[model samples]
Target chain A: MKPLMESERFVRLAAPILVGAFLIGGWELACRHWQVPVFLFPKPSDIARSLMNDAPTLLGALWVTMRITFQAFLCAVVLGTLIAFLFVQSRFLEISLFPYAVLLQVTPVVAVAPLIIILVKNTQAALTVCATLVALFPMISNTTIGLRSVDQGLANLFRMNRAGRTATLLRLRIPSALPFFFAGLRISSGLALIGAVVAEFVAGTGGRGSGLAYEILQSGFQLDIPRMFAALFLIAFAGVSLFLLMAWLSKLALGGWHESEVAREA
Target chain B: MLALNHEEAVTSHEATASPSRKPSIVDVLSANKIYADGTEALAPVDLSIAPGEFLTLIGPSGCGKSTLLKLVANLIDPTDGRLQWWRGGFDQVGGEGRRLAFVFQDATLMPWARISSNVSLPLDLAGVPSAQSKPRVAEALKRVGLEGFENRYPRQLSGGMRMRVSIARALVTNPDLLLMDEPFGALDEFTRNRLDSDLLALWWERKLTCVFVTHSIYEAVFLSTRVVVMAARPGRIYRVMEIDEPQPRGEAFRNSARFADLCRQLSAWLADASLPSPVRASP
Candidate 1:
């Protein structure tokens, strides 16, 4: 019964887009009227055209970055979860080594990227490793907390039932740890993408197989500000897409019953 | 009883628990618990559990009724005296492959498991195959009037339904003794009364020896064949009232004069217990 402009879904979709269009339209008008220098601040229209114009090259670099980010994310999830499992199994082991994990997180990835690049031999592999390190810590801490935070009453029930360690782990601890694990995935996915880009920026790899970071670097050197913006846009879009994909996966896994995933009626 | 740390009050307690027609199964001979920090959690107490007895332990908070249940459950060791089970077995329940189940204050159902799986947990832990356990799980659920809800998860159920699932889980093992620690304290009165009658039905049909812990005097009077009232501050048993009201306790029993009198008496006993001075244990 309401007008199209006033509907909830319509407003939700239209509001941000209208703001974006207004900003872009104003920028384009200012650029044309004042004849703003392209290198100083390119218009949104110029950026869009630049994206299409250099589509193959910028997109190719994006593909490389995406591959590194994906690989690093998978590695971080598996490796970090395994470490968390190990840490939970032994208190002394966790106490001895958890500080090292914190140390890895605190140390700048740029500092480690050079050392990793030097040691790993393959540039892509080194970048993946650097990204994995960046993405690893949240998974470790989140999953550790999840695994440790089993309901005490349930734990007592298991003990009363004479359930063995393996049974307890499988039936109780692992299932309880899932929501926290997925939450870790959401955070670590974004960190993984950021890690890949930062590692690429520090490595500064060139030639045919280089990533978006290198394109960004080259664009800066050539004063191709539009190209740089285009590359930056791709990275931002990919980060958002990755986050959304993780959120979707979390909902798929936990939507049926978990408190965090269940939809509440107002 | 060991003489070193335990003061033997067994003779006096044994003298009090009259040698009746009911055959004693579990004998708590001056059994008491003192924590590691030397705080007396349970003062020296004695009791006897016979088959087909519904015993409710009623007391205020920190009265160690739950601790006594744990002692019966063999979840903890007594610092003094002894808890003898089934005559010279010298073993906890399920130790010699006989089953017993403890229902906690919370439902304690696995949040991730379906109701059927939760009910089947004990059988699974006992290495009973799924094929063999299915019928039994279904039977347990049916006993609790939750037959169709086997596929539902714990979160999908209401508070009372979840507690039913917990009870079904406990019943799956066809336990000889059931230990419950305030299992209905969280529920509203309507649900609590329904569960009380349902529990009584289960008790009658199964002929189970149940040691139930609660703070509610009316609940104690309604569900129990005997109510053991306790006092706090080193947690000692103060009085034991035997409910001689006949079995198959119908709805009318709640309205009877005896029920009100029993409830009032138990309430007064509990109030007397809450007083600072330690009340003498009645014979």
Candidate 2:
């Protein structure tokens, strides 16, 4: 049983990497056989070469985009959680204000970006606002569900003890909400990155503060396809890293008790 | 059709008891429950739980046993009538020896908290600092025979162990009145019997007033001073049988012929309660 468990763990890690290698190998061979133009679709070798050559510029832009994503994610977590608490505290407030939260989520960030830029004055703050709006809904919805999903028995126990609102929220609701809140974090991290990039595209601002999206736009105008692919790769890498980071943090927080994070024998 | 008026039964149980007694901890007076959809969950029953008495409510499903327990815990208000806590109103509850604690059937420990934290929840909610509650939590765990498992999570424990932790949480509050809703109904017979004995011992040692709900007639007879058999379809009490057994009952009592006789009597009462009610049929 112990050996079988170890082998199962090995396969879980190996399977995804094996599939990735096969797909990348197929793409490289297909590009060479077709003699595709680099501008149309750069070969894997060309993308890798450009990635190394333009490392400094691409890395700086990567840093800018990531900073915006991090800031936006923090703001969303704080504000979204506050709103969720308010919603759970009063059904009337949730009924009246929830539609507006939906409206904010449904409206496209790209379409809202130009309007926000006009009003906010500062370009960075406007981009963060747009990203924050994009990332806010999951935290609010998931945390609200978590807080309200307390066990009926536990709630009765608390009431039997005459627990006050603050005591119940801190001791009972908040701890129960951890798993869902972490789930929201995983989703919001990715959305924050997406929001930042889309806002950068709509703004099209170029300067010391330009993000990877601006670099991609610049490369497109110049027909620097290999460089554009490199920028795209960096963006993909950042998004994957953010997601993994959130997952790791979730495990660290909930691994001991939560069913989702705890390892189970097959 | 077999419904006995609450007054008649209430008097019988009290009349048999010793004359010198403390005020009854809880008086559930003519309290009935009708859900929002108009299902008559309970049909206005009266019960007075005396101090240090182990009273059990037993019947088939939908007999309002759990609903009645909830009403006793004040977890839900009666749709009509009222309840008195220690001869006073609800507001006077939770004062000194007047505290109440509840044990749910599911052993509803917060999965995210350690066993120690779970046990200490009532104390924490009451604003008792960690310094004061730490020893109390340890004592409660020891009382439930779970001293070394304090740092473990709820998921790490077995079903019986989890139930013990739930019992420990109730004990940590040092409550005078303990209400349990089919707490061991889900455990295997062996584990349930073990827990039943442990619970009986706890109740004896603490002199705690307890109202327990369960579906098992044997369990009702073994652990209760008086078993209240109830019927469904406009849930109401069918009969009340006093065990007339000695205190601190154990394996010897379980193996005794007297225990078997009492169980048979309660089992027959339970079957009668589960039959379609003649009162409901006429209506």
Candidate 3:
């Protein structure tokens, strides 16, 4: 009932939807009124129409991309977390290897995607490796910092209780790292999509197993701009949805107590 | 590594009052803390906390009052001398089926956990399963006068409330000894005063042996059964004074002439403690 009234929650929900509708409606109207060429910049209506016309192929491409993204994101989260654990456990290991982690992050995935594709012998696996490299850095950086960020006082408290290493790691370190871990998830989700798309662009494979990037390349070659726009729309939509999903997951896990998740009373 | 059951804890408490029994819960035999860099944080300090005593350590910043508390809590190893916890025999802290708790200067609550979870942290660290520790957590919260706040997060509560939660966390294990490091130092004056009395009530009810560290002379005077004054240079004890005020110390006590006189004396001790060569100045 309170959400339905003049609260910030009401405004937060309505503002974005209303503004997006207005912008899209205006773009559609202007395109039609000005006799704009669809090739130059397709109207929202044309994009929507193309979406329906190419629904099956476009969605299949979307599924391929999503599958790669999921695989990469999962690998990044797991492998990155393990790396963070290693770093947390041993200062010597972290010092010896952190620079290399940074090197992997800074090197362009596009520059290495072709080599990976050549070496891996499987296009899907190659795309996943590239995407994982792109998504991996944030997870390592955030989780390591989070694991190291235990409150000094609380650390003392644990010591005073004579908590063993396993107890400290499982109970204290893991919970302390959750907020930071989820924050990394939000960033990595989008990077996963970007990485997969970039990898596909470099791979340029054109069988039925192609992802949205291949469809995009094909549409470009044929001058089918509307279909390209439709694919682009799907990618953008997917990224946004992934972000919202992670934000929701963060809220679900931490909303009861975390400062970032607890709803502001105002 | 082990904890006393409720019955065992009660029996221990009863035995504590026996004339034949030793009154000291902790004996700091000339304990000192020196960092890895050879900088001395505290000089050798000898002190003993008797059962059910409220002992406050008051000193200026950089004094080793907090260092002393940490030594007793066994959070850090002392550079010199022995620190012992009493459990029939003088033994190390944390493994004697003996319970003690420490409240840090900051609330030190896990921001991602509910108040109940924060309070149950010690029990969890001690490996007490949640099914068994839930009632103890609830009782601790009740003792802190925060009965319905078990579900709230640390951030949801105000500063004063957060301190109460910290105290509740300290109280959850039915600890025989409690160490507090300026627990109410961050609160507003009114809130501090309110919490001051609330803390006293809890102390009186629990009959806890508390070693509190604070910079405020008035706070040290009001809350303590004995106030130990410390001085910085190498962080040594300056003086120890007993405040013979009655239990459940309240507003009347706060406004009493005796309270003011004691505060003045403690303040003088602190003032002199901070001066360069207080003995030289006196001479």
Each prediction's whole-model lDDT (CA): 0.88, 0.87, 0.86
> Model 1: per-residue lDDT, tens digit, A1-266?
88999777899889999998998899999998999999998988889999999999999999999999999999999999999999999999999999999999999898889999999999999999999999999999999999999999998888877789999999899999999999999999999999999999999999988999999999999999999999999999999899989999999988877888887745
Every candidate's DockQ is: 0.58, 0.73, 0.71
Ranking by TM-score: 3, 1, 2
Q: Which number leads on DockQ?
A: 2
> Could you tell me every candidate's TM-score relative to the true structure?
0.89, 0.89, 0.91
TM-score, cand. 2 vs. native = 0.89
Candidate 2 residue B268 Cα shift, in angstroms, is: 2.2
Query: What is the per-candidate TM-score for chain B?
Result: 0.87, 0.88, 0.88
| Candidate 1, position B203, lDDT | 86
Tens digits of per-residue lDDT, candidate 2, A132-211, equal: 99999999999999999998878877877778988888889999899999999999999999999999999998999899
Query: How far out, in Å, is residue A252 in model 1?
Result: 1.6
Q: Give the TM-score of candidate 1.
A: 0.89
Q: Per-residue CA lDDT of candidate 2, range B30-132, in tens?
A: 9999999999999999988887789999877788999999898888899999988854654443323226788898999999899999998888877788898
lDDT of 1 at A55: 98
The better-scoring model by DockQ among 1 and 2 is 2
